[model samples]
Target: MNPLGPGDPLRLGPYRLVAVLGDGGMGRVYLGRDGTGRAAAVKVLRRELAYDQNMAQRFVREAQVAQAVTSMGVARVLGAWYEGSWPWMATEFLAGPTLDQHIEEYGPFDDLGVRELGAALARALQDIHAAGLVHRDLKPSNIVMTSSGPRIIDFGIARPEHGLTLTLTGQIPVTPGYGAPEQVLGHRVGPPADVFSLGAVLVYAASGERAYDGGHVATVQYEVVHGEPNLSEVPEPIRVLVAPCLAKDPAHRPIPAQIAAACATSSGTKPSAKKIWQLGELAADIKQREAAAKQLISVPDVRTPSAPSRRRLITALAAGGGTVLAAGGGGLAWWLLSKDGGQGEARKPSEEESTAPPKPWDAKRLTASQYEDGTTPPSLWGPQEGPSPVVVQPLPVRDLVLVHDGGSTTLGAYNVIDGKRKWGTDVGSYARYVAPSDELVVTVGPVTVGRTGRLLALDSATGEKKWTAPADAVHVIAADAESVYFTARRDWRQSDVSLLGAFDMASRTTRWTVPMPVECTLVTPPEAATDSGRLVLCGQNGKVVALDTHTGKQVWTLPRQAVAILPIAPAVSKGIVYLGGKSLTARKLQSGEEIWSLPAKSEFKKTYGGWGAPVLDGDALYALDGEEISRRDRRDGKADWTRSLGDVLQQLDPPVVQGKTVWANVHSLDSGGIAVLHKDTGKPAWTYARDGSGGWGMAASGNRVFLVHGGKLTAMPVF
Candidate 1:
C-alpha cells in the first residue's frame, strides 16, 4: 500500500481514507474505515477520468453491475455514491492473493484442488447469470482465493446479457487469450462467454500454462477465434469436465450448473470450500496476507479520538510489508502494484505529488524519413573515441556503459549521460567474454600452463578487482540475482564439450558443476539463457539442453531443435524458452513441451528465410528474416507486421528494442544503417544511416541507444 499524497482526499462520504491500496489508469483504490472501524476498499474515479464522460459512465456502471450480484462466491459491495464531488464505491476488503498470484507463487493446483476451484467459480457464474448479468472478464486474476473459497471480483466490464461489447476506442473487447471466440471477434456475448473464460482459468489452474497464447495480442485473439484450445497437459479427468465449457459455439458450451456438476469431487459431492483454501502452501501465503491486513487496520483508542498519524500508519504498513486487503472488484491496481512489492521494501510516496498523470516523453526528435532526408537530432552525447573497433555488445551498468573490445584485453567504462571515460582495467582476460553482476563484472581470465581458466570479477565503477575463483570458466553465459553461469573446460584446447557451472555471488564460491550433454558438442562457443531456476544451453550442433540451476541435473533436452552451423541464442521469459530456426517455437522452459510454433515457409511456398534470434518486448517478438524485419506474436510466432529491407547481411544478432522503436542493424554493400521501425505497427520510424561499417553493435539504456561504428561510439535518441 502507498501513503496518501498531496491533493488526495482525506475522507469519502462516511469512510475516512487511509493508505492507498492501489491506483491505475482509470482510478485509485484506498483503504478506508468508518466511525465504527469497519474496513472497506474504496475505489474513486481518477480526477482526470471523472471529467471523461465515457470513463465516468463506466465507473458508475461497475458499481451498479457489482451491486446487482449477491452471492457468497462474490465480494460484497458495501456502498456507492456516484453523484458526488469524487465518485466512489466501497466494498468489503478481501485478504487473500488472487488465483493468478497463487498459481504463480505456489505452482498449479492438484487435480482435486482444480476441481474445487472450477466448481466454485462455476457456481459463482450461475449466480451472476441468474441476475441477468454476464461477467465479461473472468480470467484467473479477477478471482480471489479467500479463506472461505474462490470469490469472483472485478465488474468493470460486466454488462447485461443483451448488451453489445463496447470498450474505449482501441481497447480490446476482452482479454486476448481467455475470452471466448465470440468475444474475441467482438460479437455479442452472454453467460456462455464467462463459461469459456472459466474453462481457460481451469486449464491454467490444472496446468501452469495458458489455454490460448501467442507472441502478440492479435495472435492470441486469432487463436481464440480460429484455433483449438491447448489441453494437452491437462489431466484426462479434468479435461473432460472443462472441455465442454470452451466450445467455439456458445450454444454448444456447457452452462454454469452443468460445469459445476461435472467438476465436483470424485465422491460426487461438492468439496469443502473452507478446507480447500486452508491447506498447503497457498493457504499459508493467504494467511500471511490476512494477518498483515488485520494488523494494518488495528487502530488503538486515544483520548483525542482522532485518526492515526501518517507516520504511524506508514510504520504499520512497513511492518506488514504494505499488504492491502482490497476489494477484488476494484483491486487491479493493488495487484499490479504489489506484483514486485512482496519481495523488497515498500514504496512510500512523497508528502506531495501532482494529481495529473505523468507526461509522455517523445520517442525520437527525428523520424526515419527525416534522418534519410539529411536531418539529424543532436546525439544525446557521443561520437566519442572508443577503446576498440572490434567490440562485443556494450553492457550498461548503472550510470556507465561497459565496453569490451575483443582485440584488447582491457575493458573500458564510459559514463552514459556524457561520453566521458570513467575507468579502464586490464585483467589478463578475454575482454569480449563478460557479464554484469550488480556492482561487479564477471569475466573469464586466460588459461595459464599451471592452472585452468579462472573466474574474475572487477568493480564496475572503479576497475578494482573484487574477487577471483579458480572455476576453470572459459566464457561467461549469463548472470542472475544469485549466481553467474558460465561454460568452462578443464583443458581448453583438448575438450570439445564444455562444462556448465555457476559461481555463487553471495558466498563467492563455485556453486555446482556438471558436464554439458554429450549430444551438445560445441563446434563453436554455445549460447546460454537462464530463468525460472533453469539454465538453457543452446549449442551449435542443434542440441538444446535445460538443466536445474541449483543441482545441475538435466531437466530436458531437444535434439536438432535448430540449424547446426550457427549458435542458437535462446530467449527465456515467463517460464518459456523461444528458439528461432526452421520454425520459431516457444516451449515450456522446464519440461521442453511445445507451446506454439510458426514455420518459416509460408503457405504459398515463399521463403521468408530462417528467423534470426528473437527479441521480446512485452507482447511482440522482433526478428529479422531474410530481407524482412518482422514483429511476430511471441505466443504463436505469427507475424503481426513486417518491413522488408532490400538487401542486408543476416547475422545471428537479434533486434534491439528501446522506447517505441525496434532497431535492427542492416549491413548492406554500400553503407548499411540501423533500421528504426515503430514497435507496434512496424512502420518505418527512421534510419540511423552510417557512412561505413566493418562491424557494429548497439545497446540501449536510459532512453539512449549507444552505437559503435567507424571506431567511434555515439549515443542516439530513442522514442
Candidate 2:
C-alpha cells in the first residue's frame, strides 16, 4: 500500500479513503472504510476516462460483470457508486498479500503448493464462468492470498479496446505471458483463454518463472502465438497437468472441473486467508495495520450496503447470445460477440472501418485446429445450466473466421491468430471438410443422440448455413477451387457398399452420386489423382479408382487383393496412388493400373487397429514399420533405404516432409518421442523423448512441427 498522492481522493460517497491499495491502467484502488468502521477496497476510475463514453460504459458494466460472478472463491462487493463525479466501487478488504507478492517475498512454491493453488484458482474460475463471465486477466497480482482462501480480485469488468492500452510509461497494461494467443491478437477472449492463463499461473507458482519469457510485450505476444511454452523446470504431476492447459488449441485443454479433480490433492493444507496469518512474521504487521485503520474510524453507525440477489438475467447481447446481467442495480446492459470468433462483439477502430479487408486465414493454425472436436455447450446467450459450461475452442478472428461460444453446439469459423470468431450456426457438433472458397461441410447428427446422419454446408467466413443433404457419414475426399467431392456409406449402420458424389461448393447442389461396384467397408472422399488434378479416391471396396471431378464419372478402377479389407487413404505424388492397410500397394493414378503390391507378411508392423498411410517425398515413399522407417521406391515399390528405430515403434501416423527431412512421433519400449530423419538416406538427424505417450504425427509449419494424433494437435519447435 502506498501513501495518498496529491491528486488522490479523501472521500467518495459514504466511504473515507485512507491508503492506496494498488494502481492499474484504468483506475486506482484505495483502502477505505464506511462510517460504521467496516473496511473496504474501493476502485476509483481515472477522471479523464470517466468522461469518455466508452470508458464510462465499461466502468458501469463492472456492477453487472461483478454480479455475474458468484460470491464464492472471490472477494465480495460491498458498495458501488454508479453515478458519481469519480466513479468508484468498494469490495471486501482482503487482509493478505497477492500471489505475486508472496512469490517475491518467499521463493517459488513446491509441487504441493502449486497443486493447491491450482485447485483454488480453478474453483474460482468455475464460479466466474458459471456466471457467464470470462476473467480476461487472471494473473498473479489479480489473486489475493487471504486467510480464508485465495480471493480472485478484480474480475475482468473493464473492456478496453482490443485489450491494448498505452500506459503513462508507454508500456502496455497487460501481462502477455498470462494472455493466450487470441488475447494478443484481440480475438475472442473465452474461458479457455482463462485456462491458458491458468496454465501459466501454475508454471509461475511452481518454478518462479514465466512460461514464455520474451521480456517485452511484442516479443511475448509473438512467443505465445508461435513458440511453445518452456516447461522443463516443471516436475512430473504438475508438468503433465500444465501441458494440456497450455495447448495451442483450446479444445484440447481439460475443463475446470477436470482440472480441479486432477490437481485435487495437496500435501499441505489448502491455501486460505488463515494460513498466512498463522505461519509468518507478517502476522504482527497485519495486526498493526488493522488496528491503526480501526482506530481512525468509529463503529456501528451506518446502514450496510446490500447487493441484490441474482435472479434470471434478462439482457439480450449483440451476438444474439444470451446475456443475463444485473445491469448495475439493473443499471445498464450490453452484449458482445466476435465477427471472427469470441464472446465479445466485433468493434474495429475508426481508421480501418471502411477499408479493412477480410482477415487472412492462418492456414497452419487452421490445420492445427482441425483435429479438435469442440462439443458445444447448452447456452450461447448466458450462463449454462450448471455454472454455464462453455466450450470456446477453435477461436475466431475478424473477417477471416467465425467465432463460437466455448463448447457452443454450433458450426463456427474461428481465426487462427487470435481465436476470434467469424460466424457460427447450429450446423452440428462437428465440422468435416473445408472447401477452397471458405465453405465447409459439417455433420448434422451424432450417434450419441441416436439420430441419422445428414450433411450441411456452412460458409466458413460467415458461419451461415448454405444447404443440407441427406447422407451417411460423408467424408470429403477431394476438393478444388470450385467444388467438393465426397464418399459415404450406402448404409452407415449395416452395408459395406459406398457411393461417390460431386457437389458445387457455392450452390451446394449435387452434380451426381454413383454407387460403388465393390462393397468395401472403408473409404474416403475423392482426392487429386494426377499432378494436373485428376480425381482419384480409395475405398475398402477393395480398390483405388479414378473419377472425373466435374461429372462424378468413374474413369478407371483397380481392385486391391480381395483379401485386404481395410484400405488407408492414398498418398499421391507425381502420377501414382499409394494405399494400403495390413498390405502395401502402388497403382497408377490416372488409370488405376497395378504397379506393385507388398504382401502383408513383410517385416512391417505399420498398422495397429487402423492402417497407416505412406509418406511421399519426391520419388521416395516412407512408412513406419514396427521398429524402423522404411523408404520405398515410388515406381516399383522397391526398397530404397531403412533406418531401424532399434526399439518397437508405436503405430505410424501420417508423415510430414520438410526440405530434405521427414519428422514423426514414435514410441520405443518405455517412452514416446519425436524423430527427424534424412528423407533420401533414411538416417537419423535428431530426436527428443519424454516419459509420456505420443502419436506418430507429421504436420509442420513455420519453425514448429505440427502433429495430429490421438485426437489432439500439438505444436513443438524443431529445436
Tell me the tens digit of each residue's lDDT in model 1 across 81-148: 76555878888788888888766644566566788888889899999999898989898888888888
State the lDDT at 418 in candidate 1.
76
TM-scores for all candidates: the values are 0.57, 0.38
What overall lDDT goes with each candidate model? Answer: 0.72, 0.54
In lDDT terms, which candidate is top?
1
- Taking the tens digit of each residue's C-alpha lDDT, what string does model 2 give over 1-719? 33467788788878887655456666777767777777777777778877876666556565445654565677666666655568777776654556775554343554556776788889988887777666677788777655455667764352322333223355444468888887777666667888999999999877667899876777888899889998976767788889999988878888888898888755333233233333332343234233333432332211222411111111111112211111111111122223432334343211112122324432222232332222211111111111002311122222232322344245454333333444556543333344444345443433234444566665555656667766554554455554566556656564443676666545556666888544443322233333222466555444566764545567677665322333445676434567655566776544555678776433432224323567665446777655566777666678878777666544434566654456666666677666777666776766645344543434443323443333333334332
Q: lDDT at 254 for candidate 1? A: 91
